[model samples]
Target: MSRTPEAPSAPPVDGARTTDSTGPDLAAPARRSRLVAVDAARGLALIGMIAVHILPVYDPETFEPTLQWTLFGGRAAALFALLAGLSLAFSSGGRTPHRGRALTATRAGLVVRALLIASAGLAINQVMPSPAPALGILVYYGAFFLLAVPLLGLRRRTLAGGVVVFAVLGPVLVHVLGPVLPEAAAVNPTVGSVLADPGAALAQVLLTGTYPAVPYLSYLCAGLVLGRTDLHDVAVRVRITLVGTVLALGAWFAYWVLVLQAGGYAQLTQHTPWLSEDQINEILVWGPSRDLPTSTWWWLLTSGPHSNTPVTLIMDLGTGLAVLGLFLLVARPNWLWTTLGAMGGRTLTLYSAHLLALAMTVHYDRPALWFAVHVAVAAAFAVLWQRWCGQGPLERGITAAVRGTRRLVLGAPSRTAASPRS
Candidate 1:
């Protein structure tokens, strides 16, 4: 979701009373500043995603999943979405939000940012070498931005309430209506698909794709609320961890009690002839099998990747929040955190490069080696690049375009350079 980190195009920062709870002094002039913890969290999520992509999750011999897959899988992308929301909050206004012309300029910047990210994602989809369509999150990220535009002005409390409602109801509504909606595009969306059947493409992006925007919006909204808080406050970080732990563990516990222990899976096994026992077992191990079967409503209780189920969304949200909280707590000016944050700050560029690398690699037989190589290369490039250039290439380009658009619309130059928020 932080695929395209877009900053506000130099909105006028009024000298309003700064709230200690919100951390930063918004009254200060706009400069290229970022929360290191947020970037570190994004970097960690990016690493997890790369591991999911390159490393073999399940053992070929034992058919048992690797620890990396078990830990990251859906959670990594969830973190990305959450961080994206946080970035949006900072860019829009941080604690003290913008009003009138400033708000309009911010909105225009977001629109431009979304268009750039979505276009890039579609272009990347064309060349991705994965046999199965890579559910690249870049396009979905654009949708997140577009949808979040309206919600930008809401107070933190309102955004928080929206998160609760969407987490519980969003996936449920998607499940109830998904069958009747237009069929989703295959694998990755393409420009041709967008041009030929715009309606279907919209449906896929909103309701039926791998990362359905409708349900995933909860993560974004929650991150927005968190961003409004003083991320620099130790108390705030602790609260985030506590709240996230509760949501995650509670969701998983409910799923276990209501589904497995309550005989939901058993009933599904007995009643569904289409899926064999082994197939069900595989789903339990791997996931809810991408887009889960529609034969039974019990699937809605599943907490699997791409299930788009209520529990899955809620659980992953918790996981993301917790990870972010931990990162914030540990985001000292240490070498380790700094190194990871460097990579995180440039996730858009690194993520694209990783996909390109995947497209070129013919053999994944030695997945661990490949994973190591990718991580090393990405980390090295990020560190070295940051030494010479503050921002990543793609990230800089996107930021420049958005800033230029903002300047044109607002009839003035922005006050700062591109602020990269992963």
Candidate 2:
């Protein structure tokens, strides 16, 4: 049987982006693993992202299930970042020996695509500068792509160690260096408002999420490790899910106990009812923290958790099991599956369109109506575009661009390229 062409998949740069390499033990790819999880995860993330962006349609103050994401806590960007990390590992073909030239080219392609994703994100940013800035996960994911490529073939243990060290040190790294580095502090509202004075706006984008790359990348590496290792055992999957769930709850509770329920916390909560929500989210992400450095991000990222809130302690059980469920669901509901994938596949275009839609709201002062319209139009576009164009405009362009570049760089002129890497 002849094989048709595959679209070239680019490792998503900061989908929410990073890096370098120095250490190594050999590693290999798994003989049996299902990529459907990453795809399904990405598909799920895209759906949540749409919902998150559509929040203005409803009341921002309301925390409802449909609008609240369980995975990465509804952080569309984090989901993309985790997906990128997993895809990066999957693409490593972990078994193959690293070739400097070929890997360099692939890394280059990742860098280019990361920038494209970031650029798309920044384009979205032109509309919103602060609280709702369009650039979030894509910004980080794009940066991480460059940061992670060198370690692509590293052993699981080695990468895991890297994740741990970084997670432990990243906050102090962010705080100490934050004052001097305007970009790193951009994500911090107080600092951002201060820095937005005049010259800092352009420089702040890169700094939005600095040292925290460790926590952010942890999710990716976790996904990568899961993919690279033998995770198919029924028990192993359950164990991993259990670990994630426990960590998530511990993180949430720790924050609740240490911070919110704390005497000072109650005072602040009294002043602002929303403070609890914000702190709950922070506690959920960074886990329990004295304040800064010790913050063990509850879930590698709040966005993932925020966007896809797991209703139970073992919410990841839902994420892990959702894959099998989606497969089964798709088998029974092909159209729905295709629709989800189509939205994910065209994320770049949809991402940009989302910005335009958001801007429309801000500009017209009908932000509420615009938000709802954005959701309807974007979801409809995903369904219609897949049916009509088969791929989104920007998605198609990126696919062609990556494939052609791969041909030139890899020296394999296969008529078809691999599918687009998210």
Highest lDDT model number: 1
lDDT digits (tens) for residues 309-359 of candidate 1 = 888888989998898888777676567877787888888888888877877
lDDT of candidate 2 over 98-117, digit per residue (tens): 46666666666666766666
Q: Clashing pairs in model 1?
A: none
Candidate 2 runs further than 4 Å off: 1-37, 56-74, 94-100, 127-137, 183-215, 230-240, 260-333, 362-372, 387-389, 412-422
Please, what is the TM-score per model? 0.88, 0.64
lDDT on C-alpha atoms for all candidate structures: 0.76, 0.47
- lDDT of model 2 at position 79: 45
Weakest lDDT window of 10 consecutive positions for candidate 1: 1-10
Give the worst 10-residue stretch by lDDT in candidate 2: 1-10
